[model samples]
Target: MTIDLEILHALSEAFGPPGDESQVRDLLRGRLAPLTDEVWTDVVGNLFALKRAKGESRGRVLVTAHMDEAALMVMQVGGDGLLSVRAAGKTEARGLLGQVVHLGPSRTPGVIGVQPVHLTPHERRQDLPDLGDLTVDIGVDSKDEAAGVVKRGDYAVPAAAFGRLGPLVKGKALDNRAGLVVALALLEGDYPCDLYIAFTAQEGVGARGARVAAYAVEPDLALVVDGVGVDELPDEDEPPPDVRLGEGPVLVLSDTRTLLDRGLSLRLQALAEAHGIPYQVLATRGETSDARGVQAAGAGIPTALVGLPIRYPHLPVSLAHPDDLEAAFRLLQAALSQPG
Candidate 1:
């Protein structure tokens, strides 16, 4: 499977900060319209593209990839003119220092202001600043001036351009946008089951959109497309972790919030091995994903999480390999082509 760089780049660069996901939604809507039998959005803003079964319906299958990215929300417009902001999702405070952020619908650019290291006390130099202690410099000097541009509750995202770095793709929001691209590719296929591809919203804050979506779709079985953390650094002395970039898409056995279906996990692993597609597995304990809502919806939906392992997840800019993304698409395509 060939990964579409154009679509992946567009999704990665789209401004979708949790509650405000219209930009990402609209982008997906246009692409999905021609590929599916029907396209629609639910109340919670989960965009659905249905590609009905070509012959006798085997069962209903739901595939989801979150549209929202970690962001900062403006909390106050201080009299001093710098806007106070807080994390809207799992944004890392340590990564926020000196990074540029685009605020609200206008996409007004701002830089997170950090105290100069030279001016800071020695002990405090290594301290990470809380979200409340940070300010965004949008080039204004008064509360009245700042109010004219941005207001409280407005969302902001880190500014980063999407591009390829040799085998790796780098950009903000690849945490799930890589998954979005995989889901998009899946939409082109005609499956044995009635396929519902959900471009879910507010996943970064929680698996909020998927909860409503799963109830609405009522899929018999499901597959969650997401991105997982890759914890490799060149300077680290320890042995490398099992999950790594360029390896392949990850088949998550279990995570903090949800225990994935065993049958589905085995099917994915077997399919990958049979087809000679490279793959990896993870049973990480700390992080969670949209699978939390999806697997638990409507009594129960047996769901599996297939993740694209990415470096620097939840940060302003993340990195992934094109081959890994393509492998993920192939694995999913293979799964849907076969009967449940």
Candidate 2:
């Protein structure tokens, strides 16, 4: 399958932090409009595009790719033009320190500040700094001056530059954005089953958008695409020791919230082997995806989870192999073409 690097680049860089998904939705709407028969955006801002099956509906198949990434909300402008922020989701403060962040509307740029090492006391130097102790410097001198240009509640995210790093790509928001790209690619392909491509929102917060999207579509089969944590350490003693980057996409068996359907799991494994698509088995101890909330949507929807093998997931610089993305796209395309 030919991958569209342009689309992937655009999606990865687009701004959409949980509830604020309009910008990303607009980009997807334009790209998917020509490929799909119908396109609609729900009240919760979940973008759904449909390609009707040729004959009687075997069953609705929902493919979801979350549109939200970890971010921070501006809590207050400090007395010295510094911005105090509260975590919007599961972001680590250490990863954000010394990183550039983009503020709302005008796209104001700011750098996260930490006390200089020479000024820090020896005892406190080794301790990790808490979020409350950090501040964002936007080059202004006073809170009154800062307030003139920036406002409270504006979202802030890593202003990381996007580019390929060897075989892996490094960038912010690659976790779910890469999955969104895969879903759009599937929509643009020729699949046999009725397909609903749902670009969900608020996945960083309990898969809220997915819950509503699944409830609305009521699909017989649902596939949630996102990134899964992979161990890249030289030593093999990490908590999740099974998965690795460049191996392939993961067929998640179970996570904290849901387990894969037994029949679906076997079918996916068989399909991968028959088509020569690389795959790995994942057992997430605490993580969960939209699949959990989606499966419980009405009576119950059979669900499967496919994830790109990502290192340092949920961090600003997530890593994913291009081959894994292609493998995922192929699996979904083939599964939809099969008799349901």
Candidate 3:
């Protein structure tokens, strides 16, 4: 269940918005071709791989990890070379101000901008700028000049480069990219059930890719692996929560979209304890993952969520511990190496 940090870093930095996931999928396709019995992409760009069971046949097990990142799309360009943008997913507009964004497949660079504080109204000095008032600057003089390299409906994401920072890894798209790396590790595991690993698209938008992939696979059991942020609020604001950066993976019981199956989650917890793999129960809420759409598919499919605790999940410098990711990979490999 160990991961190659170099490959994981590349996956985190690769550009792929909700609908435009070709770049990320291409890299995954290359890596999976050697390890899987069959690897292919669906109409919606979800990457599915199969590792067939050898002897006795068990049910299909779908393990999902989203490929899309929280990003923005170009809405319109202004006469002043500034571009208006729209959210591609549940984008955190507040975190976007003054951040660098990469545009399109070429990775063209741009910066989200707002008026300087000196020009703002005195009463508004302490308030954050509105997303509606924001614009992207690509250094062109006018709208016509900007059209040479930019266009409407292009994808924009945080210009985050991957690297190790002390004991943590910082990069963009860690929310689900961490899950993608964990899923890749399973390709090297001993599969007791027929494993169908899905690197889903459009999860940042609405889990659109997961819904379509689930209908196609129709597995008896599924697991959605995603990254959850560690609460970093000051103690004065609230007492510290159990979630921590260096802690092992977070075992999620429920989220905003669906309440995960308790029996499956308990089984994972019991396995963690028996193997002495450090883990913590996720105490945070108000989040969702691809598991929601998959669990509600035709005839109903039971699913659970495994979380990799991260900090500043959607911002430019999202942070995660490598140990947490390794833990997640090991726990899942062990889970799938048994009968469903």
Best by lDDT: 1
* TM-score for each predicted model, relative to the true structure: 0.98, 0.96, 0.97
Clashes of each: 0, 0, 0
Question: Which regions of candidate 2 are displaced past 4 Å?
Answer: 236-240
Candidate order by TM-score, decreasing, is: 1, 3, 2
Error of 1 at 64 (Å): 0.5
Model 2 agreement with the true structure over 157-212: per-residue lDDT tens digits: 78876789997787888888889888888876666678898999988888899999
Ten-residue region with minimum lDDT total, candidate 2: 231-240
User: Which TM-score value belongs to model 3?
Assistant: 0.97
lDDT of each: 0.91, 0.84, 0.87
Could you arrange the candidates by lDDT from highest to lowest?
1, 3, 2
Worst 10 residues of 3 by lDDT: 125-134
Clashing residue pairs found in predicted model 1? none
Please tell me which model should have the higher lDDT, number 1 or number 2: 1
Itemize residue pairs with steric clashes in candidate 2. Answer: none
Per-residue CA lDDT of candidate 3, range 154-247, in tens? Answer: 9899988899899888888888888898999899876778999999999987788998899899998999898887877677868787788878
lDDT of 1 by residue, 1-340 (tens): 4679999889889999888899999988988878999999988888999999999999898999999999999999999899998888788787888999999888999999988999999999888888789999999999999887999999999899999898789999999999999899888778888999999999987799998899899998889999999988865778768799999999998987789999999999999999999999997647889999998888999999999999999999899998999999999999888858
